[model samples]
Target chain A: MDTTVVNTGAEEKTWGGGNKPLNASYGKMMMWFFIVSDALTFSGFLAAYGFSRFKFIDYWPIADEVFTHVPFVHGNYPMIYVAFMTFILIMSSVTMVLAVDAGHHMNKAKVTLYMFLTIIGGLIFVGSQAWEWATFIKGDFGAVETRGGNILQFVDAEGKRVALSDFVVAGEHERVEHESKNGLWFVDEGTLPTYTMQEVITGFESHPDLAIRTQTINEQGHKTVLSREESIKQLKANGIGIVEGANLRHNEYGTPLFADFFFFITGFHGFHVFSGVVINIIIFFNVILGTYERRGSYEMVEKVGLYWHFVDLVWVFVFTFFYLV
Target chain B: MAHAHKLEILRGLIKFKSNTQKIWGVLILLSIITAVEVVLGIYKPESLMAHVLGMKALNWIFIILTIVKAYYITWDFMHMRDEKASLRRMVVWTAIFLIAYLLFILLQEGDYIESVYSSGFVKKDF
Candidate 1:
């Protein structure tokens, strides 16, 4: 006996395979899912940073004041360099889009060129960020950290920030940092600061033009500037040690938490950028190798383009929250 | 897959001949927005500093502009516009809802902490 199968097309439609539910390729869909999760992770970090800023609302360091350095010229041009960095990243996103368009058009030469431009843009951004981190670590105007963990910065009569090296008188005393190789078997202290507390105190006392500025913001939205007498008194009463730059434990800018968050968020973004550069480099060579051309589609270029664009998108938010805000 | 050549960026008010042109248009828009943001941040006009709904008007502007930039980057650069509606909803909606919920909870907690500190529960000065 021969069995007859039902010709119901409806059942076949219900169990159909190879149909993209989102109308996206498998790789593109997976990339979107990854982006969503990665976005959430970044949001969590940024929201936590917001929480800390709110906690010390009035005492938060001013972004313009903290990030005022340019590569070579640095005469208090606020937010200029960061603005340039943002522009560069956004331009890189443009190049990535162009590369995707070129891929769609099956123009191998254009794709290679655009991808090369994108890689260059990423390199410049990462290098600039590294320079920024270095400048932040080597603070311009040194401050004295209070015993209570607050920072007291120095200013001149006109309320301009004054460098510690400007007035700090070096003493004949030699400072030593403990190393593992040094006599102590288990005690290894970090590198010592350039200037000592005694030197700062002595220098501050002699410089009548210098005053102290607290981390607290005044009604005018600037750091509070104290009178000369109050400056000396406050420093003498609360100053415990000299803090020249930012670290995980100490921040000459303000609360150490700000520095901690800054390092973690920006460092994480930098790592993302680094990986994006590496991925772009790999894909660049692939485009030159005509791998995708032989495959008859340039979907791989589009996929990596999505990733590159996501990195730019994240940087936009990071720039807003960290620098502009 | 057949990709559309023309992109109606502003509901057909502005149209692009090709995808490359559309990308350039979006880039210009993004750059202009960034420039405006930078200028506002640097100057911080006093009138814009007036508190509106507990936040400065300037800050509100910055946040809104940033969202606009993010939207365009995701939609255009990432080609969310060309994707199927279902795919777009799945990716965009999930992120929107999750991020909103997370921000609400975190920001509320942060406001509470701010109130606690400002109300003198714990002296910050040591």
Candidate 2:
């Protein structure tokens, strides 16, 4: 059929370094493409979070109250702590960009300096997040009496969240006890707590002075809150631990859905920050080793730079929704 | 489009001043806004407590401001606005569809859960 055709270089190879469509290196282009996909993934997770939040609109637990712990401080502080964490992540991103600039100019010392700062910033941010998570898991004074398996909290005489034990006199009934796992749930030796829930209920029934009043219910039929005296009396009368999710009733905090979304969205974003830090470290090492300088291209640093910036980008959204909204 | 004065813009953006200045400025602004939001979240301002449009006024403010800030970070700080229109459209369309879908489904399900909660268990007491 005589279908043989001779190559004449008529159309140049549209890729490779010369005569390229974008005129950028493969590595940089790949990084950009990856960033686009990653951004979408994050957005999806965040949007899902938003949907759940909007669904539980009226009764979502307050974020500030829930996240009220800071590192190196013991007392109850509000969202001030997380606000600080957000700033740290954003600052680290700036440092990463500067390090990339240094790499572009073949300044190893400057690159190292900026990279070290960025790493420190990332570490601090991660540590802070861990501390916040620990506080959340342990929980504060749980709900003493719950309307919907949700916790009910009250301020004590000192206007502080008081444990159920604090109000009751010491020599009441025994507290809850658990058997050891060694035995079919071990009856391993341990002291039982004072004042069982039944005992507290009986105490309240017998003692008018110790009549309990819940945050939900007051002396009157109206939903009036109690004073410290009434609060103590109520706890003394009907001793019980904070709401501990007896059976799917709503707790003091918003729906369990709120907590679920909190862990998922923030957990995902934290993972991104963790990986972003690792990637930056790899780029930092390469810059120090003169990898890009030898190849006459610092695009490696730039690629990592884009990833770092994206992490910051995602955090801005996370901070807004999780912390503010 | 080619940069007619790219070098000038880059140089004029800052001289002796470092990039840290811009970073700090934006960061401080963000922090201030956060502080304001935190205050609102904690106190649940009485004015906001008064029901408006079937929700607390504070919630309305928080959601609105949060979206605005997110736009700034995405468009300006992240330089998404500087990208090709196709890239921007790809991101915008995906976000619009996915976010709206998620909201619709989850919210419907959540409201259903709330109904189950209110009706099934805690009804007699109230």
Candidate 3:
């Protein structure tokens, strides 16, 4: 096989196939194509989210209220932890670009250091996302699901949120959870909520200061709180079950769709971050072993850096649409 | 191959001494923009709550700032700016146009369904 390009007369034409029209290597161009397709995939998911949100535009769950937990501090601090996560991802992106820059200069030491930092940053971000998911699943103030599937939360006279434990008194009724082993072979039930509907209703009747806050948002952008009389009427007549946390079937937050989108989008993005970290580890070892040094080019590092930065880019959009917007 | 980077951002208004310096500079700019977004989200001023172009002015600000951040991340971190002009357009323009079209169709359909739910036989509350 002839290994050299023959000097064909067609080589001088603009339509010649021998030239690099895009001025990019094959690997880099393929990476760009992959990124573009992946971006469209993410855009599809985000647009679906926006559609759901717009459908429930009047009563969509407020992001600040839903994501108000910090790891150690107890008070309501919304958006702080998510902001921290965003900063970590952005800073890691900076380090990744620095790694690629060092690779350009052929400084093996700097590339190794920056790659290590980028991996650490990726780990921290993924861990934080896991923690966030856990916190979201374990809700704070429990709400009652009405027969109409509307969520009814408890609030004090001043409209401050009140936890079920603060007011609900457990009754003496014997309750048992159903299991596949104990119940019929094919039958089972989910975990029982901490407070039953009877307990919540009784508790509401006993506390005159408590009010019912519906999922509907008023013109003031706040949940509509009913008067004490209306609160009692709504609870006794409509309250069917207590929703303690979030799941695919039900959410103590406004709508179940909100929880579904939250899990799917963030879960997918977290999976990407996890894979990015794994790839960075592989590349980090290759850098240490001087694989690129022997190859006489650090283009592999540049390729992986493109992927790492793309992950960061997607997170920027995720952070905006989910948390900030 | 030694590659030369265009060492400026914001249409040459902000220049850096080197590629590494540019990376840090873009990082700072992104951080500041994120900070501003968080602050505005937390406070949610009354004046900004007024409707503008069928959405809240505050929300418009957020969306615009988000696009700005996306631009810097793509151009600087992903080295899209250094790519050939044809490749840049093929990647960036493709995503942008498709996303815009998708959002328009989906949101319009969503709004239409919402109106049906509000006024049509499908009752919102049982």
lDDT of each: 0.90, 0.61, 0.91
Grade the docking of candidate 1.
medium
Task: Estimate, for each residue in A29-112, the C-alpha lDDT of model 2 and write its tens digit.
Answer: 566677667777876777667666654444456666567776777877777787788778767876776676566566778888
Error of 2 at B82 (Å): 4.1
Residues B32-103, model 1: lDDT tens digits: 999999999999999998889988899999999999999999889999888878888998899999988988
List, residue by residue over A2-121, the lDDT tens digit for candidate 1.
Answer: 488444455447454555667788998899899999999999999999888887889999988899889889488888999999999999999998998888889999999999999999
Which 10-residue window of candidate 3 chain A scores lowest in summed lDDT? A171-180
Q: How well does candidate 2 match the true structure in TM-score terms? A: 0.72
Q: Write out the backbone clash pairs for model 3.
A: none
After aligning candidate 2 to the native by TM-score, how far in Å is the CA of B14 from where it should be? 12
Question: A324 in model 3: Cα distance from truth in Å?
Answer: 1.6
TM-score (all chains, Cα) for each model: 0.94, 0.72, 0.95
Which one wins by TM-score: 1 or 2? 1
Give DockQ: model 2. 0.35
Please identify model 2 stretches exceeding 4 Å from their true place.
Answer: A1-58, A145-148, A156-160, A169-195, A198-255, B1-25, B42-45, B48-57, B75-77, B112-126
